[model samples]
Target: MSVRATTVLTHVTASAPILLFIEENGACNTTYNQPPLLILERYEEEEHLNLVPLNRTKHPLCNYVLTNRWPIDQNWLYVDDEGLHTKSIDREDVSIAFMPVSQIQVELNLHCGSDLRMKRSLSTNGEQNWLGPYDYGANKWILTDSISYNARRTLVNLIVKDINDNSPIFVGLENEPIVVGYPESDIEGFVSPRFLVKVEATDADIGENAAIMYWSTDPRVVVSPNTGDVHVHNTATIEDNYRFTVNATDRRGSGNTGSIDVLVKLLSSEEIVVITVQNSFLDDEDQVLSALNAAVDYDIKMLCASVVTGNIEPTYKRQQSDDLGVSLRLFVYGIKSQEAIKVDRLTSDLSDSNIVTVNIASVLSLQDHLDKLQICPLPGRDTGLLVATIVLAGVVLIITLTVAVCFFLKRKKEHHYDQFSDRNSLASRNDSIKSSKSEILPKINLDELRKSEKKLQERLDAANGSSIAANDMLPVIIEEPSKMTDVAQTPKETLINISAPDPKAPIVIQSIDKLKDSGADSDDDDEFGEKNKVRRKSVVTFNENVEKIIHLEDGLDEESSEPDIEVYKF
Candidate 1:
């Protein structure tokens, strides 16, 4: 229902002023037409009514009303057939209803109950017309009212306040607990400017809520509240691994806190002596270690050395005549400070020698330096074992080759000897065959035999002409080759063939004078005739007898045959 007010005046005059009354559905009311002044009241935003103001301005009428009358108590109003009324307005017969209106009208409509209670509604886009999260600043909100043919819109601004709701969280260190390595100070009881690690965290809140402060309870380390940088303290010991909790807290209200695990590794206080030596010294590990130990004036421990080859910084100086030389790097540890100085001095003195340079560095810095140079530490034990295995294998190979060569030489020698023996055996067999084909006997010297036979014949003739009787003399039988025959005769008149004398027959020789002086005589004429017949049988009898004597002188057997002639007959 709509309320309509009609102005009624009892007297109207320009100079006396016009008096007017308000009538609503025939109900009278007191009214005075002063100067037709329009009053606009300024109102602040009310939480319960959900009434927000876009632009509010102070007016003189609102101040005059507020200063003259007591504050209006908020009460529920109802509309009836008489008009819009309240209990206080019924008693005083004076009521003013202040209804908000919009400056711009649109096509949308907003419906409210008679009690002026607002309910959530959806727009044409099917989205609920509601407020979003509260953000600090002026927030714009559009309120629409729609009727059958027209709609009105009002613009309202909302200023949202802030509240501590979000907690600070780590930013970069999200996957695992942060692990950082820091070296302890080389000097005793001193703290170095070693940046351990940086921890970063962020908060989803704004203003004072996003301001994070870092803190740690670990005694060995300290965290920068503003920068989140963790630093090691002087009390931190070497070779220690420490774990601590770092908290990030915001600065709003009862601050929301976030915690993270951080691991800090404190390295040892050892120093490294980097020695660059010529490649010639790389073969003998003992010599290199000894020289290094002597130069440093300290005993080098085992497994504390690492060898590498590469282009290193601060190389050795070379002359024009020197060839390009490779460098071997030796990284030695376990030496104290005093020895490190000695090493430095020796390095300067031996700069032009096999030792190129020796540099002393802290463990951390040296590691960084090596990393930049891309030099890796060689494992001493593994390298040594590999070298030993290679050397042993080489030695075994050499021995095997030597043995193989010796065996080959021995086999070749044996083969040559067998060939020589076969050739010699074949030659000997040919000689034996030739010797058997032509049989040879002992040679008799014909000239010497004839000479001796002539001498013997002369002796026999002289003996026969001497006083030895025919019976006393042995008959010399000389048989012709044509007259040789086998004949049997009386023993007193034996016949002999003198052509072939028996080589084994014995002959007796005596002096012809001695035979004559013996005076032996023959009596029987038959014996004398038989001697004459035997002598006539052979012309070479004396020759054959002489040959028999020569055969005896030439070493023929004597006892094999009896005498062929009788020299002296008894």
Candidate 2:
């Protein structure tokens, strides 16, 4: 029960020597050149011949031969004995035929009168010959060496010998040394691709004298050196079965072919579908939002998802939410809580009137999407508080200023009144002096005062004629001598006294100084009294030089027939 049968040689030529071979047994024998043995035995005395002549030239020894005899002819004759009592005799009808030999051992041992070896004997007379067999200890067969044989070498030296001569020969592989390299991958097909493949072959018997030949199941594959590099002329196929064979040869025309079965199952180009909602009315149109949707769909489709940042949005924050969504779908196949999508609002608050505006940005990522997107409005109280504060400040400032101005004006008025009252009051000596002087000051000029006494009397009469009782028109008088003396010290008083009183009117003094200056005498007064009906009397008397005026009760009697000057002090 061998798994495989050995190569068999079914046809043998009759013109050549035919050999019977048993490969594993290592034994063989050659066919004889002539038919060797056959003889007949009678079964019932009717004698049957088992021999037949086979005239086929291709097998000239197909017939069996029993005796070395030809066809015989005979007639009846008497037997004769030599010279005594026997007569001469002849027997004629004879035949040459063969019958099958029953025992091979007996036939080989049978003695025959005709010697077939003697027909071609070298010696003239028949003689027995002896030969000696080789007497070595024993014949033995051994293998001294082995080699790698290709089909051609095995066919010539090993295969042909095994078939034609029953020789003990077989093909063997020597395990030749070889160098193999994987191809470089980057180059396209066979043109110095990044993936490189190469092989160098060598045989033990030939050293570097080994050549390589290659064949591929795929025509698109190209092998460099036609024998070594397993290069892909075209891109490797993904779904096909391919085989590559490398035939390593020796200088002796021996070759060994090894094959490799390759399943070139190249993956098909990926089907990538990027979905974008170009029309965006709100944040929903953002790339992140769109990408999120894609994640859901892609997850359902069992496709990988990824977010690709592009010019539309470069950074993570600037990236459109929709694009982020898509990228998440691609990378994670869906948006997970851990990989949250960051949402950024691209908005402008035109209504906000602050000179500086706030920029709102948010990161929507696995960790912070929901947390970052929460928006809170500014408190309303702040605006009102600012305006109210400004109004209150303005009002307070105005009131304070008003109060200051009023206080300043009132203070100024009080000061002015105090100064005026201090200068104008009657209790003040300064004010009293001014009043007294104003009352006593006469309207008369000094040059007019120097007129003739008659002219003065006429001017007095003229002045007295228009006044009441003429006493009111008189000069003011002073009761105190000191006050009277004080007025006399002024030059203006000398001018007022020069005008004499009129004889018909009484004199009244408006100033104490005028009274003191009046010289009242009895004889002059009697003369002036007869002419004048009224007289001005001084309230106090004064010595002629002392001028210490004292009031006189009746000593200066009204009927003393003297003119008196009446004096009064304000």
Best by TM-score: 1
- Residue pairs in candidate 1 whose N, alpha carbon or C atoms collide under 3 angstroms: 106-151, 109-146, 110-146, 474-566, 477-541, 478-538, 478-539, 478-540, 478-541, 479-538
Residue-by-residue lDDT tens digits, candidate 2, 314-336: 22132333432222221111212
Q: Which lDDT values do the candidates have, in the order given? A: 0.42, 0.30
TM-score of every candidate: 0.26, 0.16
Off by over 4 Å in 2: 1-381, 384-388, 394-398, 401-409, 412-421, 429-451, 454-570
TM-score of 1: 0.26
Compute the lDDT of residue 436 as modeled in candidate 1: 77
Sliding window of 10 residues with minimal summed lDDT for model 1: 62-71
Per-model clash counts, in order, read: 10, 79
Residue-by-residue lDDT tens digits, candidate 1, 79-174: 222222222211111222111221111111222333122222223223212322323123122222221211122222212223456688896456
